[model samples]
Target: MDTTLEELYTQYPDTVKKNRKKHIVIKSEADVACPQIEANTRTIPGIISQRGCAYAGCKGVVVAPIKDMITITHGPVGCGYYSWGTRRNKARADSTTPKDKIYSQLCFTTDMQEPDIVFGGDKKLARMIDEIVAAFHPRGINICSTCPIGLIGDDIGAVAKAATERHGIQVLAYACEGYKGVSQSAGHHIANNTIMQNVIGKGNERKPGKHVINVLGEYNIGGDGWEQERILKDCGYTVNCVMTGDASYEDIKNLHLADLNLVQCHRSINYIAEMMETKYGTPWLKVNFVGVEATNESLRQMAKCFSDPELEKQTEEVIARETARIEPALEQFRKICRGKKAFAFVGGSRSHHYQHLLKDLGMEVVVAGYEFAHRDDYEGRQVIPTIKSDADSKNIPELHLKADEKLYREGNEYLNLSKEQFEALKKEVPLNYYEGMYPDMKNGDIMIDDCNHYELEELIKKLRPDLIFTGVRDKYIAEKMGIPAKQMHSYDYAGPYAGYNGAINFANDVAHTLTTPAWKMIVPPWERIEEPDTGKQEGAN
Candidate 1:
């Protein structure tokens, strides 16, 4: 049987023909080599990649979780503005906590500006920290540097160190430049490493419950982390501290107390997991609460870690109940989404995870590409048995470049293209007019799969896709054009869209976007406005 790529080539010849595999032709060859999928391609030229920079990953995902830690953007105002309350994690605002209530649910940021970025931001960051300390008296302050800071070479670490000594508060400086790598995946790693070095054991560390585990990777989007929190508690384990979701400064410092670290996001938190193992002698395990399969496996794994039969049995019961409740809904989604075609081009981790979930929904991924992925991420895809030629390399970007081939050819970067392979791809994965790079007529349909603002407008006019699955940015455009658009990134505001249960959530999100009432009301500018009366009003006439 032919491999998926081989089948695509055979099914559509010119649009899908094969290209000779790329071998690393050295610069001495003076030849323009075809574009091999480079992990560095995460920062697309002129195109805004959905991937966040290092500062964002650290500040948004890692540092922000510490409810008691004041985070300062230390750059342009747009950075803080864009990130403010953007995460799906839910917390009861301090206002909602009854007057007598003791807990505070607040997320804060030191919004920075142009002057801050242009001049060194150290003074501003220091002042911001001081302001936060004076107002909230936060237990700690985390200063996250943005792109400009890195470019200007502002020493955020030095500032943080000096401030920590003066204020007698924990101050962490994370230098996550946007240009550092392709996606937030890299940012996650950087953040994890910093935490291991700075935040892990800076304060009073009291040993907690023996069964306690440090939850990692889960971002608590849509309160997903809280839901998991409840489930774990029900299972009788003390969730010592969640990595950052609904997490606090005190909680994070005490993370060392937990006997084990339970990580949900393998790509992002695995580094920390490994570090915990080495430093504290605490073992770590990967757990996903996204789907029934992963969720069950995760619970069982946790139980095994404890070697407790009763806890395992209780976990089984919880799974059975949740599975039964969602079974009917999931079956319905399977029926609807079966055989639907999808092309995934999100950042790597989600791209990889989405493959399994989509396959479960009976949908086929016509094309899949990761904006930033390394050699390891491609192992399952690269080794597919049925692949016949190098053209099949598109299935796995790294495979396109033979071992000897250098990735960057001499002249211009954008000029890099594989004529034969691109032609075949044009056919094999015929994008719906809306999805492909250009508007030129092609033999097959196209889905403008991975896109940003500019592509959204152009493609809407040229391709006129039936449905556009994208992030929040393009939702309005697709709607204005009278086409269905689904925000797949954050599960369209509903998710845990990971396993079998996620299938139902995915379908519902798609359907909701497709069938929503707002689409019908959109009208063209010319049609909606009546011409202004030039002839004039009653009295003047």
Candidate 2:
């Protein structure tokens, strides 16, 4: 099919078509890097954008997930409350939860009222930090400023410095205003640079054992961290702290101790991985546990990195065992889900990650896109050098890093290879690499970026896909259209949809969604009493 913008949106008004055409690209080859789709730009005004702000990207997604750090949203109460716990980054705080972690469960905010916003919110923020210390005595407090703080220029950095002195604890202030950039992507870069500068390498502690790796970007959503840890630990890889998810301030401080970093979400946390390489020489491997094939290949690559005979054997053994365990059900689900068309539009990297899982189930993703990913995310890292820094991107600060004297790894110590072998293996492994989401998608498959409500609705009506893989916001819209939509972001509050067993959960759930009988009632009786019945010649009464 010669899929073109005009053909796809023939009925759309010319103004809307002109704006959106560049954002959408029909794939011409499967998984081949294509740079046609425009990405990482500002959304058109008047569109109902699904993109979260920089504040949500930084405070909500990255910084706030630390199990022992108190993240205070330094603006309105609503911003604090709404972003709180919405991610379902389910963390554990035992009955003996420490004082530092107590405030982790609670959402703290300055509640920057009119008076505070007018005069300055800095005083209120400082006061809030004082109150937090007096009550919780937390080890660390991350102040995430909202839009008001940026507009008013309240000097949160000074407040943080003063608070750090007063409380004798770690107080980090982030200028992650909600309106900072094109999308939440700006916040991700902000958070990554901030942590790399202030937090990581601060501790003297070391995580012992061979194959010690930190899993960056795997936020413990629905116990994803637990499941990943389970597999990795079982495989003899000592799982260190994630970038933020379920990690404590103490745990994160020791991040420099890890030999290797395994990155899951490319858009969100890849910045940290890159900076870590620059500063500490800790090589990162791009790994995806969301799909069976991806997990297998990722594990194989990881094993190759550490050329241990036993570890390699162990990785293969685990793969065979796990694949056997899930193959029976996966096969059955594949039979049911075969040839089902899907459209995935979700936050950042999952739009790419979940496509593998869908493919595992024999589903063809007709369309896929990201809410806050850059051009590189869709076109591959080869495009990074070419991507022009727009005004919005330029507004966010980039860090300059150098190797730390004590913590930096001198060579490829993480990879068990001889100097010659290591150099040769670079061609094979290419550590700290991500191929983006393009290569996996076939020609004629549409790739969109920063997708909106109108585009989604129009595409769904036009394509009539079997599955809509999206977040909570648009799930119901698909259901209303009598199509099954899977909540890929939170997995509908039930997932370990990451590795071996999680793949089974995804397959079963997806199969159930498609095969479920309840869908017959989608066009309820109240809405439509009878079908058109074009075949019966209308039984003229």
Candidate 3:
């Protein structure tokens, strides 16, 4: 009987703010933790939670980046098929690259059949690696586990070890079972850890770009990495490597050569960044490349760290030129998008970070949710009263026998579940997902976290948000639905959407989505005419 706020209303309310009072309020002194959701929650015997396991994160985001690596989704074909290049990370294979080398850019999967899952996926994985080697001759392969793999106890690490020895190349295994954490965030950390262990420094290669820096956490989505690279080059610094986005195996092998690391997405890349700093004697800095404030500050801060007066001056110069380039268009977008309301549900740092950028365009984020976030990410944000997991809700539940029909009455404890059940839950859950359950949303606008296609489509159909800012997956759907969906993930093909120049890019991206002619191009299935029967007369003609 768990219900969404929209289900409670007779009709979907115009705004979350309008129907805020109808929802249940958390009682003070409640235990405030729901064992069902506590990463460790043992299936509650019956409550539903929308958290993905660790494997999904590793296979989906981290390991999927290996353009030259053959990845086997070692459980089910569905996971592999759905996750194949789901993001906007463009591959070099599709470009003017040679056909013989196409395997590097193509998404290869074991496409595990049911039989493999029933018995185990070890043999199939090894066979898939063999096939991949014959077809692409890649230097390495990765076997990523899925839900069933975890359940069946597949020792993918051992499998990878055997395969690597047999092939005389690198082979890594990731144990990212989706249920491993509360959200995909845990997967990111685990992914970073695996990279640190196996990929950081092993090969007989070193291109020490003395003036270069490693750009961490900035996935080359929509060429965002390329844009950042241009800016750095303009500032007279070579970008030696990008973390996973557009980063090559060789580039990563030589990553130690960089003088410093500039980390953008702190939540996902912090582990690797810190590891580099500790092991290599390379300093790392937390930087944001989102809005004018963060971008400018990040540049100035990095320049200060470099202790190079000329570099500091170059940073200022780059900012000035880029800022001037987009000022007029930004002003125009401000006029249309200003004062508009927004709500977000994104992975890791993006959910909170984008709020400031949206605000730059004069938009207000009435609601926000994160799929995988740490406590520090939410420390300063206000927590609103709403339905939350036992860990965060702090509410207690009591069974009230009201006229023979026993109903659970609200109590001070946050979790309604019994202790025995929570104790049986898993080892880790992404902390961010649990935190999302408690935000005082005020029901002002629609909010979602780790939303799937169906939920997003439904929300868009009902809410009709003014300018939908989300990743590329949701972008096309929004456009097809006649809703303005901006690619916040890649700045919608116009980037650097961070920094002083980025503010304009943000505005421009939003404006392009909002007023673009493409929104008008959505044609109904019934709109077009059928083909004429001209084929029958081909011989006679």
Q: RMSDs, each prediction?
A: 13.8, 4.6, 13.9
After TM-score superposition, what is the CA distance of residue 316 in candidate 3 from its true location, in Å? 1.3
Per-model TM against the reference: 0.67, 0.93, 0.69
1 against 2, candidate with superior TM-score: 2
Q: lDDT by residue for model 3 over 248-338, one digit each (tens)?
A: 6656776666666787776667667656645654556566677665567667766655556788889999888877777677778889888
For all candidates in order, the CA lDDT equals 0.56, 0.84, 0.60
Off by over 4 Å in 1: 1-37, 41-44, 92-119, 203-210, 356-361, 380-469, 474-483, 495-507, 514-541
Best by lDDT: 2
lDDT of candidate 1 at residue 176, scale 0 to 100: 70
User: Model 3: which ten-residue window has the lowest total lDDT?
Assistant: 406-415
lDDT of 1 by residue, 365-445 (tens): 443444444433333222224334332223212211112132212111111224554344334321111111111111232
Sorting all predicted structures by TM-score, with the top scorer first, yields 2, 3, 1
The TM-score obtained by model 2 is 0.93
Instruction: Write model 2 residue lDDT over 287-332, tens digit each, in one string.
Output: 8988999899988888888878899999999999998999998998
* TM-score, candidate number 1: 0.67
